[model samples]
Target chain A: MDGSLAERVDYQALVLPYARSPDQDAPRPVRHPVVIVGAGPVGLAAAIDLAQQGIRVVLLDEDDRLSTGSRAICFAKRTLEIFDRLGCGGRMVGQGITWNRGKVFFREEPVYSFDLLPEAGHRRPAFINLQQYYVEGFLLERARALPLIDLRWKNRVTGLQPQGDGVLLEIETPEGGYRLQADWLVAADGTRSPVRRAMGLESKGQTFRDRFLIADVRMDAPFPAERWFWFDPPFHPNHSVLLHQQPDGVWRIDFQLGWDADPVAERQPERVIPRVRALLGPKVRFDLEWVSVYTFSCLRMERFRHGRVLFAGDSAHGVSPFGARGANGGVQDAENLAWKLALVVQGQAPASLLDSYDAERVQAADENILNSTRSTDFITPKNEASRAFRDAALGLARDCAFARRLVNSGRLSLPSTYRDSPLNTLDAEAFDGPMQPGAPAADAPVRAGGEEGWFLAQIEHGGFTLLCFGEAAPEDLPGIGGSPLRPLLVVPAGAAPGKAAGLPVIEDAGGLLALRYDARPGTTYLLRPDQHVAARWRRFDPALVHAALARATGQG
Target chain B: MLNTELNIAAPDDFYEALVALHRDLTPEQSSLVNARLILLLANHVGDATVLRQAMAKAREGIGPAGQDATLRTTA
Candidate 1:
């Protein structure tokens, strides 16, 4: 029951407590505020978030152990920020291998090197490569620390009966079968989800014919922590290979196996060793940690929410791992759903608020699917003309910068903004800079009362924040009263000291916040609890702010 | 600068896909498929100069002269 058990425990061998209660000998129906199936990263994140909001959650998983192999390793900046908000950022960031630079190779020659993080003054890195098992381990540890989260391993939901108001679940455990009821059910049960199948729903998309052999090798080689991708390398003639450095001196090598490859033979250690040696050369000594032959697809359900039952993560949608969209997008889904579900459960927001989750995440899933499909298409062109176009782009990349821009080994995962989301209040005034309404709030360096930190961290505690820029917060703002929205004023560093801003004032040390938010003297932004910009204005208008809040919360 | 590089992302997959497209088709049918695909793609490109450069580049890779009838027609 100790909280520190997770920190010192070797997660691979960490034995989780049994799912059932010691005293319960007979099958008795139990009820929980929220029941989340699948204890993977997405479900665990949602459980943690809901528990933090004082919502009791029952998280169930069919398996008792962490995910096998280094699956879904790349954690994007947005994902890290969400993890930070959920109280596990430091551990993940400290253990993760941070890399922003990627080198795209045309055959054996390096054509372009791109920096994902072009600027500084942020808390998290552009991306980190940690094994997926570690991610689930950290989430489980955090979940165990929360008293409100009742985690049950080896508890599989075999039956689902939606009763219009709530869901009746029949769970199969190691001991015996039991019945339970939940106000809401989140099916995060992954690609071949039993929850989705039980409801007779299917994911529809294109399944790629090209298969890939993923070999995780443990080697203490001197390769830098950068993404190295090859297109028709000389050693693996005619096929492409990708290499990435993960934590604990392990490296991920992905080799494209043509459609004709025998899956069984290709997976054999004898066959895989030679191909890996071809990439690493003759003298590099390494041991294979894991090897898997996988075929990917870009698939998603028609809707993410079905009545009180919601689907998150791979259950709702799936994409190829080239862009790291699989787990990263799923985590984003958890973040987007957690707050909305919390509000709906607490009776603070109407049931319509949960509808926004369906709207927003479906759009986000579509964006991920579109990018994934494009990258897959470019990676495995369907015709000679497409190949010709791809080759032309790569060949020109050597000499021309413009052509280099066209070369996409993998676009990599970046946060998708809901620009046209129904919840976003469109800008009534013109503005500049990258951060916009419906986009995740960009982080900036700031100093508050002589303490230096980031802006996003200061306001990410629990609820919505009203950021007033370049001015002192006035007493008793119209929309601030009787709402979860708290007003925080950010003044330019050049502003006069010792001036009371009615509300809490944080100084933007170098005017970075103002510049990044494109603020003049009176620019104000309403940010959601998930750190997404809901609405903004050049000047404060109580009526507009109220309407935007209403729309963002699904009251519109 | 026009893109003249042959750095396709997955050349093996592309080759396999191309082969699959012409799997059961006769030589004449395959030729017609190629012709139709070329015309459709040319229309998509919608640039005469780029198309001409691509044609010239294609011809350059096929050897000096009298190699393919398509090259002679384009010339």
Candidate 2:
């Protein structure tokens, strides 16, 4: 079985041997520490994180080839930070399209323009709009480079059952039906997940009546790279469209289909091109790369995990693509779950730590679903009355400064905190003033402290952060426990106010700038790896904070 | 865990205040407020048998004081 001879064999013959051993006797079966179903962004992300922690992983995907469809395109700042921790941030950042602004148009006139990235912190830019396929490709490349990751393409998970202390996975490969036993299983197979169905979990939510059409095109026209939303293009009354530019010069346009149009007929170029030309104006030339028609739906699984088998990404929840939260949320789910699983598997933390995965991530999924639903509701209003109302609202906002600020800031996609989470605490007096725990302060400059960079320059450390407001010393606050929770770090607030931090910190803005930093005397805020405030306190509440940390790490 | 009363609202006062607030709000404010209200209402309606019936009555429209005359009659 030399390399050249293996390559020369009939492709079918090579696949046939593995295909014959259908019941757990295959060569590569039952050896993996963890088996992840689906090699999409979420699954690959889990593999990357776990492999980095020295755990062997087996990643399976039913597709014969890598995904080419650009299903999801938006990557938020928080998601980019996760990539940074995985050591692939530079490659992804280089390949993604940085979008900082968006334009909203009413008929022919520009009604509003929003600056999505008004502030830059220590990490990468605020957000990037890259094709989802490229992101997965980048992750796949990185995962393959790791010797611990075994990526098996064209392999489908047919049966999953809890076996012994681990789980048994029945996979259908070109060779045959093979059985695999792993310490844990992650189901990232998507909305109609076999794992979820096997566990008998039901996804409950609302399904909209309207369908949407998304097209990726290469065009010669000079359209700005900023995201553009068109409300009621003249030729197609009541229809809406969104235009976004990708890094490779491909443009993605999402059009709201008329309720009466035949989805099959409307997708034809003759019908689609006319609508696009009418909106872009008749003179511009373009080439359509891909087009897809899908009806939007929102759903969240009743539970993300059953015993040792867990679900992530679309397997756990499904959201309309309006807010670009689908893929990003899934990636976050893996990020949140991976570390906890790794700690438990390595015996650094108790098994109970894995329980917080559902507690925290389910809350996040519900939030993502709600945000996407609201964005969809606004974009594709249901009836004539709703459409009219939306139009009037946009028209009114076009002339008002307050309305313009609200519309353009895009506060919805900003990072959110789990203030009330069992893993978090609240500091009533700490995050006071206009800057609260859950939200970012508007246009707050990152100034230089005693350090070289400005405030906010310390957030790039990629671990739990303690931002001490006012003049409190970091040592005076509560100490973090060892092992699983030993990674906590503290720095001055606004270490580099205007610049992004390479590490997280605490700060002192000269005088009593406590009002600005929301600091009250001796308060502290503990931030999670994703930069969300996990816990806070007016004073050093070590007993409660320790309990929270224990609970978050599953030591409880 | 079953705090049904926590999910319940003072229909007469709350509904009236909501209508008044909706009427007085600017379009942008109204939209934002409406979105928040929808989420709040949905949270309370979770897995409740009475939710569908309540939504049906509310959809028929509310009076100036925020109470749904239809809901009052049905109740």
Candidate 3:
């Protein structure tokens, strides 16, 4: 049977049940410490973080369900670690495909392939392919279970006013309209953010001329779970195609259509089926799950923070989808902002601490935009000269190892280091390995209390943690006025696992943690709640660590 | 030696368009465009040896008129 005639593609709508909010019937205006708009993955992740810190958050969403399509299927290792911190890592990892290798092809011939994770000591895989809906569902469940989070659905913000101390929001519910005042407003309302529009801010950048057709199909194909990309593939002449395997046997296929291609005509099943049939044989039994024609633009706001309102996720920036930076970057934005916002709301840090969010994330967004733009240009060359260069690079890639490094289908999202961030205390002592000040805390497996666990799980618990390596315990570090510090003692190999200075001891039995953090015998690391290295020293220095903690919390 | 080659089926049209692309530019702008074009073309022909050969071949027709090898014509 021809694939086109296969019973009209069964479209299953994923809808969450909506319930009337008690706030809808309230007669007076309510005030919340935090009011986050948009219940997407970003907003929900923020809500979970804030709630876990015992802050009451009012989370609002206009829609009552997870995203319809399997958008943002690839979850990077860093993002998985974040989800682990949010308490949903087990479910997501259990339900997704773990893939670390990707193959690149040029016109039906394999050109090059790369392995992402060659090391063996990490807790998570390089990436997992789970649909965006599953991620949101897991996050929503986690957010709902927290008593501090008030998740409201069918609630839309109609107006906003940035006041002196906070922001005012006029929200519309199905039954009636209501007013809410919040000390801080989080706009995770996605790409077409109403909050951003209400604030009269414009995102600026270049919009690519080319468009891509994404199709999610379900079939029991023999394709392995890995990323397969092609440049000018024989099935689709002069165009690029990418295929990936998601959970439940669903496969995502993307085709790059030139700038002049008609989006409407290209989306029709009659047109899409032949394209899929060309790649997968006509006799392959497959059901088309969803189809979309999208043109991506790499745009970001001039600033992520404005007065008392902060933008995150797609609301703060958008990038071309080639690199999976869209949702991955957004989740990172939530992680970065969640800790800083919680500190500000709790009065533990000066509000200026929030400015780091803008500085760090805007820098991150720029990095994402630049990389995605380069990938887009390489995949779809604009002029004859660029096309020639692209073709030459791809052509020479067949025989030359140097040319293989030049090919850029998509770089794949890797967490960018905030080495230059203002909050990072630069290396006063020479260090090696990836774990440096302002770097995301690297995860390593170790023995803790007779059980093996990750290093990151001990540091990111809504407060600063002092990782005391070796037995030399620095005493009486001056407090940063308000924030309490949790001390964790990491003992290297050949060191006995005994509780020293009343801090729990972890045995780095294999010396993996020591290597990952470049830990000397008496090295100390002061990590922020978000698990980013704020400062480190060769040995424990009470006064320097105190000042670094103050600066990390925006007290300086 | 060096493949100073444009694979377009219509070389004349490409040449006309290339020249027209700089028609309205000032002399400095035209020079800038030419420099950028050279860099782009050189980058495409990534092999340094090939680029050197192509540059030597291109310089052959640029000396004094009577001495130019490729352009010297019998009148």
Candidate 4:
């Protein structure tokens, strides 16, 4: 049956207890090509990608309405690229707050301020501070307009039974129970993933001893729009009073509560207002918007996938929010998994490729979790001796430039690559040099013939971007032996590399060798559709790259 | 790299120097410089218990009366 016609087939009619009203009748059992659990960013992204590839998706969420809580506000540059590829990057970039610099304070005084714009090259959008709920609302609206996606709110997945060639899911909806069978299942159900739990995957990590109070307050007094960390003693000695301005006049302030601070006592406006007044001084007036308590936990699932069912987002890993890496990492995971899943469903690749998703993404998640944990540990030290030590050290950095950079980079969220990835080639001598495979530092100018552009812009279009250091032609390197995956144009220095067909390449004047890809190279990177470094090799090893591509496309 | 010159000062001297340096800085510059100092010191202390107590004390001192006393009034 044609996919367009199949999409038109009434799923309600195929299932049991069909009635005039959806609420009056029990949900009818429906079989979809793919069933995704959770309607959050991760699940929705996966659904959108798969649906675009002509796959039918049934997205289930237990919530009766779209989530209204502004959970994640920080969107990294790499995530923005993903949004761009999804055709919604402009919408988000338009609505979000672009924060280029931040200030760190001791008491009410500023110690350092640095711009997020990289020292060189055109700046990719730094970090955006739009509410996560707004992003979800935008994605949901787009997802609903698609004919191939059926988003069911207030429906929860309660049971899973592996059937022949597919899995059967027992869904508990408000109307009643129903069965959903699909060729593949994805769990984006968040940190406490029911899908992951049902599969009995153990999530491993530690919980911190401290708690934090996060509040969105509307203040009348002027506050720096930049992200600021205030480390004052006495009132907030054991706590970090950090603040970031939203798109509007609203400000989000996070106060690190003492380990012994009572949650009930902290939530009271009377208790919080006094602290706000004390910090801002008597002249500043403010109104509390919302308040909540959060504890830091760093954990990742043992594996991202189990058989045909896979996990993405918080279901796979949880990290402290210091770097805003948690949600960004999850979205990247979806980008990595989506294309591979689509290829497999379309019979273009082998299932073994799915293993690389686990291999590559788990490491990325682990790294992000570790970085966030370290950042949190530093910001919220647990002892008085440590506190004094921190104070003195920060005081010393007051006069130091290098120390400031170290602290700033640790807080700034950037893309990280897997240097030793089987898909990437490492420059033996330049290993210590800038262009390390996994380092997200701004790309340097490479002169191929005479033309010039930042290394990132050259590979930003996605797919395998071969950067020839010497005067080597594209034909000289190994051609993509199998699959329809497009090869980008070879950019020679001087002339702007125009998008050839759909594959665009840029040539550099500074002769630099090795290939730089936007996504994980297949055969080389098995490149995730979103151009993050997935894997690599030093030279064109056809056998290995071929095997990798096979695994990535799921042909093997 | 550790600044031997900065690390060699006595605790009270170090605090006094920080106060003097902070007083010389613009408000925007003082906050970041101070926060960075606090982060570095925290890393070296290696004890969470002491850090927590000190932070509690710092918070209390940041109130109106405390801020006035800790900061130089002349500046």
Candidate 5:
């Protein structure tokens, strides 16, 4: 499946046949602004994101094929939103099995249930159970479509020399090795990141001893598209089981095999079948698509950014699969670094802005690790008292609503708000709502240019966006010096169009946009290029906006 | 905030009912039931201040602060 037609990559590579690259023929090293290694979800996201920002991104992967198994099947809403920013969210939501409700059972009885997304007005579902291959295939397809992205298959990073200004990488391709120079390097490599190994960096943290067996079964089961978790079931006593429906009539079943259970023995059909049969009853016929066993660790690097090289995804921070934070957190890591790297490369902002990526993603990593670790502990209690408390909570949860809060099947995943990020301009004018400085901008429906669209879609076009919500549109707002700011005027649902003389007027349809942002008559919000709130005010003020823009861009 | 003062109207009757609830149960089962009871009562008394005060009271007779939270329920 390896070929040397480096100039063009067929869309059918979605079938995942490796192809050779023209980099093997380059007489001298070709320098790209951004070179992203490992074309998994994180790398592809980082590549596509940078390419979307008009940065020439060289995406390299050892294999051209998608991930072999149905790994990292659950993608959270925050991830789908990030994909939307990369122009592929609609397809993801459409292709994946969307679910928001998850029920946890104690023995044979359901003890706890949670709605991930109770409120409406958001664009995507709480989560979608799409196979990792489908996600990577879609991202790969999107990355290939971008002319700025130079995607090289069978390109493995063997050695790296990180210098003061840039990094020189030694790449191994099917046609042997080639040297390439990158102004900035992004390592989205998996947990066993070769780049991190080459740099002598270790992602250190605690490892949970328990192993989980994942069996992707192709079946026409009459199961609703919701997450079902069973703890200490009658069939599989003293263990946990999780069930999720995926696309293509495939169902993901996870059986918590104890710490001492041999992964080799547990993955076999003889051992896994009886467990599934016990849970689903004998009448249900299903074909095993894939079987794998995994043990997880919640780990992260001391810092994500190392001079000219930046690490994103599993390479930067690795979390357990309990909360499905592994892939979601990694995709977010890419999103966090993309804009800062783009700015730094284009000389729009100082290189110091990249440090903010380390600060923020490290915070996010710590958050994910903490949640995943807690969930692991709850699921597999180490001590007698902990197990006693866990069972006590589950026991009480059968009748008591408060006991449900003590139940921790998995926290799922939520986007981390950069509440303490140095980039945020803390609100000078007090406002009510969750859209605080550094909070990820919440999505709501709006009407713009006679077409109904998402509020996030308006700010996602990139760069600093100043959104002014009010009845009286201040004809035009003054631009912050040096930095370009796209100002949007958001009026109430029934407000007259063309209110802001020369600016785009977004009608907050159904009042959801206003309600979600807690908009007052003259409220305004300044959103960063990554669609995170930079600052907000009761009214528009040029001086305040200028100061926020400077701060968000790292000038302040 | 916690009505650490006798709050139950028929305190002795409630105590008898509680004792009856643990009847014919193993020590582990009784402990679990007690834990559940604590959770339910604390939740019913939903005020954070009250719960914290109650928790402080519960922990008072256990041990010193440093070693108090550590469970000795080893295998």
Candidate 6:
């Protein structure tokens, strides 16, 4: 179905066509509510998420087309959930390969294997393998569909200045340069961000003295959609290799070339084809779709927010590709910042609320960087002691179950909880479950309207929600500024209570909601617009809910 | 809770079995076997407090190294 969709179209122009903006011909600089730089995945996600909340945004991209190669291929479950809220999750999942299992091998034997999604009753898979271009192409289409997202291709941000409480940007186009003012600026530009360079800010961290050669090969080999990683296999002695299946029968194979290997020599088809041939033997046939040699560093800015300019994605932080944390974490940054930018732009929340974006996402960046660094260290094993321990673990893993826990083969990305963010209302009573305050809300099967639905869809419209269990929720919540806070009443599939005062009442399909949340009768949870738990109580109380709302919006 | 007493059911047999675990192995292989044994026993214990106590006892007389535990002394 997808193969015929883009068979003969001018793919670049069809995805994002360059057009002149009105400001280029105007005499005066115009102001927009929000302006997002870089039309990459993070920037497009931010634009779509913010525009969905009724904020007008101007999205600028320096380039005229999607990213060239299959750079980022693994999209985690959290990112898919965020994309689901944007109404395009199905398109991405339909065009991507989903996987939840992985295998790790040592020498000639399989040491350990894992299943990422062992439990049932979840809406999305643990992850999906899709090329970076397909992801950007689909996101560009989604951004174009939203009326409020003014996506300007070929508009490059050249100069930046901070005004009283806004940003003045100089954009360069084919015609000429034009000036624009924005109340808020989102820098989703990637590594080597022009915005960061323009502002003269320093990003500090350590860089690995090694290079990885990624070969995206097109083949019809019958490999399952599972991640396979090898440590010192017989084919690639004393080095590592990773294999994954992307859509269109493309296989992503990464080879670890030591620091001393000449990148120029290794990238040649003569060298790459021989290495690939050694692994697949003589029977399999393949063609190299794309190949690149790259190294990575773990770095982050001291602060993601600089006055009116907020940085997201690789602009704010970066890590090695071992954990697949780079793009996944960046997409999460968009989801974290979008709703706060919306609320602040709407005058419904204090600007101080934006500081929590730094607090939460910086913590998340630190966690990702730590994991990425540790996984790289395990994969490379820099010193004698480290190598000994790594080999010992691998040797023992073949016989003992305990050693399997010690192996580290790219700790995949998971949503980070804002455990210490100021926006959370600390639990006053004891609780025991995964839906703790500040954790991303979990998804469960539900019967909404009439058909079976998902719990996350109830708050998909970007509103603060009150999820009350086993009872009818209050009639309406007093919102701070715009729409009223929505209420969702959840009951067992067969035992729903009275209708929630004309509000939508969803039924828990198999009691997974109750089990996952550890809920009792009259339990009410305050979920933020970004679908993160802000507060919870054993029983519903209007006064307490009001306080939590204020605190969550940064009044407290 | 760490039983300092001699708790092996068969003392001579346990000593011989311990020797057999590393029999005919090189120094590096013997050390790896000992390290794996430590990890397995530590996981079997599972009490972090007990592990810490045991570590302190094991390192009682060893002086501090010239570098941090995470850093290389050669550097």
lDDT of 2 by residue, A1-556 (tens): 1112212222112221122323246566554568899888899999998887777888888875555656777888767777766767667777788877888887877888877667444345667887777678678767968998877776788877786677878778766667788788999998888888776677777777676788888787687768888877675677788888886677888888855658898789987888778767878888887788887678888778777888899988888787777888899889878877877777767766667788778888888877876666667665544554465556656665534432321234545454445554444442445344433222223334344433333444434555555343445343453333322223245443222223233344342334445556556555554445555676555676666565555554
Model 3 chain A scores worst on lDDT over the 10 consecutive residues at A1-10
Candidate 5 lDDT, A384-469, residue by residue in tens: 66778889899888877778898998888899999999999887766777999989999998888889888888878768888888
Which segments of model 5 are wrong by more than 4 Å? A1-22, A475-483, B1-24, B41-75
Q: How does the DockQ of candidate 5 come out?
A: 0.21
- Decoy 4 TM-score against native: 0.73
- Estimate, for each residue in A1-556, the C-alpha lDDT of model 4 and write its tens digit: 1012212222112222222224224365556678899988888888877776677888888775554545688888777766655656666667677877778876656777877764543324678887776577667756877889887877878989876567888878666777777888988999888887777776777766777888877777576557888776455764678778765556788888866789888889888887777667888777787687787678888888788888899988887778888778888888778877776677766766677678778888878877886676567654444444456555655686545544421365666665544434333322233445444433446543344445554454333333322223234243652243434333444555432333334454443323223211122232434554433444445565555444334453
In the range B26-56, model 3's lDDT, one tens digit per residue, is 8656655665566557777789898888878
Q: In model 6, which runs have C-alpha deviations exceeding 4 angstroms?
A: A1-15, A474-484, B1-38, B49-75
Worst 10-residue lDDT window for candidate 5 chain A reads A1-10
lDDT of prediction 2: 0.66
By lDDT, the candidates rank as 6, 5, 1, 3, 2, 4
Residue-level error in angstroms, candidate 2, position A535: 2.9
lDDT of 1 by residue, A1-556 (tens): 2233344556666666665654235456666789999999999999999998889999889887888889888999999999989988878877889999998888879998999999887878899999988888888878989999988888889999998789999888889878888999999999999999999998877777688999999997888999998888898877788899998899999999977789999999999999989888889999999899987888889899999999999999988888998899999999999999998998878888888888889999999988887888778766655666677677667876666776777778778788888789999899998779988998888887678888888777667888877556544463374457887788878575334435667889877888889998778899998999999999877888889888888787
Order candidates by TM-score, high to low: 6, 5, 1, 3, 2, 4
Flag regions of model 3 displaced more than 4 Å.
A1-14, A472-483, A497-499, B1-75
lDDT of candidate 2 at residue A318, scale 0 to 100: 86
Clashing pairs in 5: none
Q: Could you tell which candidate, 1 or 5, scores higher by DockQ?
A: 5
Ten consecutive residues with minimal summed lDDT in candidate 4 chain A? A1-10
The lDDT for every candidate, in the order shown, is 0.84, 0.66, 0.83, 0.64, 0.85, 0.87
Share of reference contacts found in each model:
0.00, 0.00, 0.00, 0.04, 0.24, 0.13
Q: Model 4 chain B, poorest ten-residue lDDT window?
A: B66-75
TM-score of each: 0.87, 0.75, 0.86, 0.73, 0.91, 0.91
Model 1: fnat (fraction of native contacts): 0.00
Looking at model 6 chain B, report the run of 10 residues with the lowest lDDT sum. Answer: B66-75
Model 6: per-residue Cα lDDT at residue A13: 47
